[model samples]
Target: MKGIRGRYGQMKVLETELDSTVKLLDTTIFNKDNFYNALGRQQDFIIRPLLGPQKIRVNPVNNSLYIIESTNNKQHFTNSEDVYEHLLKHEFTKKNYVIQTVPANNQSVLHYHRFTLHRISSSSNWKVVHHSITGGNELGKIRHALPFLKFNKVVRNAANLLGNYYLACNTIVIEILQNKMGETWITDTILHERNSKWSQFHSLYSCKALRSYIPHTELCTKESLGKFLQSLRQVVLKPCVGQQGKGIVKVTKLDDNTFEIHENKQIININDFAKLYDYIHNHYLSKNDYIVQQFIVIGKIDDRLFDVRVMSQLDETEWIITGVLVKVATKGFFISNRASQLLTLEEALIWSNSKISFDKCVSLINEICGKASVVLEKNCKGITIIGFDIAIDSNGALWIIEGNYAPSTAMFYKFKYNEMYETIYKYINKNKKRFSPHSD
Candidate 1:
């Protein structure tokens, strides 16, 4: 009997009797002598590295079996028929696995994706084909090359904890599990904090390093707003659960007698405190759950506000900094969000023209973001990926502006960081079973 070991891009032979030890073979430069030496006086074996469209050689004189190594894990076979069956299992699983996004709207199919091979599906809950009873359909026969089959297993991902919602697969799920919050994590986090700004403040304030970075934030009540406006020259009022830079109003005191409010790149000079107070009362304090925060003077590139968006993922054992890019805001825009231009770390350094050396800045961003992720992960229950929005001030001090659990990994793909993007998906696919609550 012969044994096979499979890994992506490579395949090795294992001696079935001698403790199932693996014998590595150099596939590119085939060495018959090396293979003979590794498994001498035993059954000679053939190994094939089957990438897409690659040929696999068959030895007529010897016994051989196939091992299919998927990106997620390994599968083994004892014969060609079994190998075909295993391949069918993978294809069927890929076809069946579907992710229906939250809100279950007309766009639910848009978020459907298969975990086996990372691809968005045009349809969900694939049509079940009962090939065993009636000769399989043409598509089933062509795809699986089998006449009879049984696939009754239900593929379930995520949980009903948040009412059967499907959060996109990746590091975002880690944050939901860790924070015990679902798709509405932001709103949930605020609500869980007793609907107070201090709750969000206290969550991060527990970390010593993060404490210094957090601006002095207060609930936007009449008394607190007055105190903040008097004390800080530049203050920002943010809607508690808002995203994408929406509903953010920046107020900067010009003098004791005059101040300016900047929102959506439009500026209005308030002549007196009454106007400022009225603005706050009508636009923010009374209408929304707003937080008043001292605004940090973030570094800019070409006079456009910019910040570093660092993507990190928790792998099997440790955290990894997957990708880092600088997001430059649109001209005259204060927020560097999805609508902003993205720059590679090197490009960002060149554009900023800061005194700090490029290599040193990269190292600092990676270290700071990595450490910050660890702190957030430890504080939360099971956070996997942290998209840290880090800001560098005029003085070169690094401050983490925010940590987004469900950040878009599209930046990595857009910047041609496919390898890093794939690594994050590989981790997510490997641990997909744990995505459901209590699976750990």
Candidate 2:
């Protein structure tokens, strides 16, 4: 009876081995060029060809698999043990292969591991595939994803609390900049201080301050605001909830009975001040929060407006300049530096050399940026990179236009590719050092 049981077990093992062999043979045959030639133009068969040859052997005793493949007509044996060891060292354990077809009948194959691949159909034929890959473990994920999440939530809350578009923009800018810049430089930082109530809590140079140049302003009623506007010969009315140089009206009192309102290049006469006020009140004013900021004429070049955007990063003790872009206003546009017509800083400097000394401008920029770094470390939580937009007047006085927390590195790649790569490599290395366990 015992001999019969042992024979049964042996038979079971033999059957398993035979099944594996059949599977390998089938895969090899399906992968052969002759098989494809015979199958001809079958779409399914063409698309689902076996990936590789099946001249492979599995050793259950040693938990290893071996594959024989020809490269340059020379056969090579690859052991699964070696392949797996290499993959493990490189952190490629969780892997996935995806094949997708687009509207233009184009196919894309993606291989990913330890990351999420999200595919969304945009239209009948158009599709967008997003691959978010993260190295390291749960702690790494938390460190990387949290800042952006917090930023989104903070923006949403600011938008809700501030009814005026300008006020909301101010709030978001100040919060982010202050966090990056810190609290000290914020106190006397002057950009445009509007509505002192909001300004009190969010002072320029402080983590709460939005526009850097403005002084602390008081929140005033519409009637008070109208009186203030009347006092000034010229004033700029900006919609609190606007961006990209939109909905800005520059009003200049001409004489006793007339006023000039400028929108872009077009100028119109304002005979009825009350009507103008009503227009602004209904369109720009909000229940949340808004500011009537004092405007200053920014420097111009060749009868056009332009601003310099300096990309910067802190490397240990040094503040490194990554790249600089000059935003030139389009023809008939009053404000330059809109997203549409952005040029490198070099281009802008060459074009507007007569207006300002490029070398001096850069020197001043670097100096101020160094100060900005000090502000960032003190106020902001975990910001490593900062993009500062500075507007230099004809007098060469630098004004803080705005600050971007997550600036794109595409512009940097154009001219400073090596610098950009080095920065990235350093950042990755720093992260590795921080996360990797130290050995005794």
Candidate 3:
């Protein structure tokens, strides 16, 4: 009974504080006459007294929120929800306010302001107030009040507010930037394989299967491995846990006298099979689970090997293709990526189709991308963007080489320049619209 009474007393005090702060904001607006004067003007002018004269109005409808700060004249809407949430989370209702306004005639001239109350009710305590002004239908009459300020305070003090939900929404935005997918889709091997949905796709070999869908491959012993290697003409060994084209070797038997060893195109002739076996046994196969995959003869472009990177993103309802680029290998190297050298998709298509049709190559490339997305989404759920690296075989069949979660847009933007940048900007803005407060 005592605890409940104490809690009630605290709530009453908070309510009183909110009421006092709101009245203070109301008095400031009515006393200054500056805000009313601006509202009475027939011509549009942003009144941004909150952060001072230097801070431009941040009305979302205007799209000129940061016009004064930026030289490019492009207005970028910085997400202010995080700041709002911080105040609410810390129960700083006495220091927070929300802007209420009528629709503006031009919609682009409205402004938002934030003011600090240095001495509320003749006390040394400080508080923050937010205000918004918009043009109204009436010629010189405008309705203005601190109603939203009170409502926002009420919501902030409520026990079951949507504060956590709003925080989650903000976190989703942050995750998009940080590329933190989290550990959601990682499951068992059979399930992961089933999710991949590609019959030809195989899992990387590891001692303990990391993904539930991929089967744990057994390490090769000398007796069983010798029998396995004898059955194949050549095999490429890859580190199961490695990335970025590292720790890969191709072993092929030439004749009874010699064997060829290839590492990213550098070749060496080894006469002692025992020494070669010791090298593989000691360095690669000794400790880690390694996979012996069949070598793929990738199609050449301009007499140089290249792979296509198709980028895609998931919007509100559907997954859309953002752009594609070709990662061309350096003069002597075989792998093609930014780490190697990147070429525009158009350039690669042109070079590849000097002896073939560009349309045909694109069709094949799109098909591979479609399949890769299906396979990837099966393994990973709620994946918004992905880059699929694909290679075309001499037989014209497309092969999925790898997939990247956070793909680079540098090559795509560099190739198309302004056009691609604008496209991406528009896409981000569209997503922002989906999360507008009105959408709630």
Candidate 4:
């Protein structure tokens, strides 16, 4: 039977008894014929290329190089030539700065990704500890883990561990695949700014728990917006630190230079990208910073775009999915904050085009969010309950929209899921002692 993706989102065909081997897709042109074998079935951990900008930096302590950005970049360098020169300057004679044989596409695509691999135990090979039911690293089914180290001098020197993340555990084994098509593959590194929209995207982009859930996001710029609008039918512009969807604009490209921007209940048409960019800057970014994201056409039911918000709380040491709600965006708008209606997972998916059964959907949500909650706690401290905003694509694939640290529980109370509402308060009351033990 045909099943599972190999590379570039292609399904692999298994051969008959006579062949007893896997066949590749003709449509997916990979430089290596054995790309599947390379990516398939890792024993210790799964480390693959992140599809976006590539920025190289020297890890001076060990004299190694890293392709810095996990996905998108903020355009530090004006062009790719600058990035190449930067890479060449940081070259270490011992290791080649780049290696060819990229698995995704052969043409002008900068291949840059980093992942830490570790030896499981004395007897085990270095590999990922676990994957979700369907398996594979993507799909947010990945687990957060770092191979526990013994207290010793050998462990103290990080160079002893594998490459990739952080200084010392360098199992990344990055091989820069130069662009063959001659077009410069875009490359820019990350400069982390906390609490902003990009910070959330950065933390989860290659996170062991939520990498697959993050959408491609970058600082809004004339260059970045133009690129996003050309490739994506729609791109969302939002204040980097706004709440309740106050300054979010959904721009849909109608034709060459023509565009549509939706805000609140108003839709305005613009004829040029320059004009659109100028208008957004004047209206939304005059005082605050903004970010542009490749918009996912969140699955719609009854002509209303909607997404799922999973309420997660700590049940002792383990984070549990306490409740799930389908936030139905206000009609003629995509933001779910102004939800016209809220429905249980069953209520919404029953009417949804999602082919998966309700039970399976719940199962996936728990599996994906289970890992997400762990990462959330590590990144966001002093927090126990989280509202994970998840997008349900047309084909029923779930992608994380973002997490609400101070999520509102009123929806659960208003939607007649009082049990869920009470459950939330139950968690809050229970966890009160965890933070503050002083009692009346």
TM-score, per-candidate, Cα-based:
0.53, 0.44, 0.44, 0.57
Candidate 3 TM-score over all chains jointly = 0.44
Index of the highest-TM-score prediction: 4
- Write the residue-wise lDDT of candidate 2 on 1-440 in tens digits: 22111212212222332322111111112223433242232221111111111111111122233322211122222443463343234322222211111111112211111111111111111111111222335565454444444334433332222212122122222112111111111000111222222322232245322335432232223544555566766666554334445666666767755777777778778777676665555444422234444445566556677777777776765667766767667666656634345666556666665356778778777876666655553334345666776776665567665455566655445543347545654764674565457922
**What are the C-alpha RMSDs, in order, of all predicted structures?**
24.7, 25.5, 26.3, 17.2
Error of 3 at 390 (Å): 0.7
Instruction: Mark the regions of model 1 whose C-alpha exceeds 4 Å error after superposition.
Output: 1-190, 193-198, 416-418, 436-440
lDDT of 1 at 245: 78
Candidate 3: what lDDT?
0.42
**Of the pair 3 and 4, which is ahead by lDDT?**
4
* Location of the lowest summed lDDT over 10 successive residues in candidate 2: 182-191
Which parts of model 4 are misplaced by more than 4 Å? Answer: 1-194, 437-440
User: Model 4 over residues 1-440: C-alpha lDDT tens digits?
Assistant: 21112122211221111121211222232222332332232211112222222222211111122232212222244433453454445322222112212223433333222222233122223332111111123322232111122112212222122211222121211111223342221111122223456556644654655666677776675666887989988999977667888898899999997999999889989998788877876576543557799788777889998889899999878999888889898888878889998888888887777766789888889988888778656655567888888888887778887777788888898977669888888898888876675854
lDDT of 1 by residue, 48-121 (tens): 22211112222222235444443334455555555445444543332111111112122221111111111111
Q: By summed lDDT, which 10 consecutive residues of candidate 1 come out lowest?
A: 170-179
| Decoy 4 TM-score against native | 0.57
lDDT of every model, 2 decimals? 0.51, 0.42, 0.42, 0.55
Candidate 3: segments with Cα more than 4 A from true spot: 1-234, 264-266, 272-274, 338-340, 353-356, 416-440
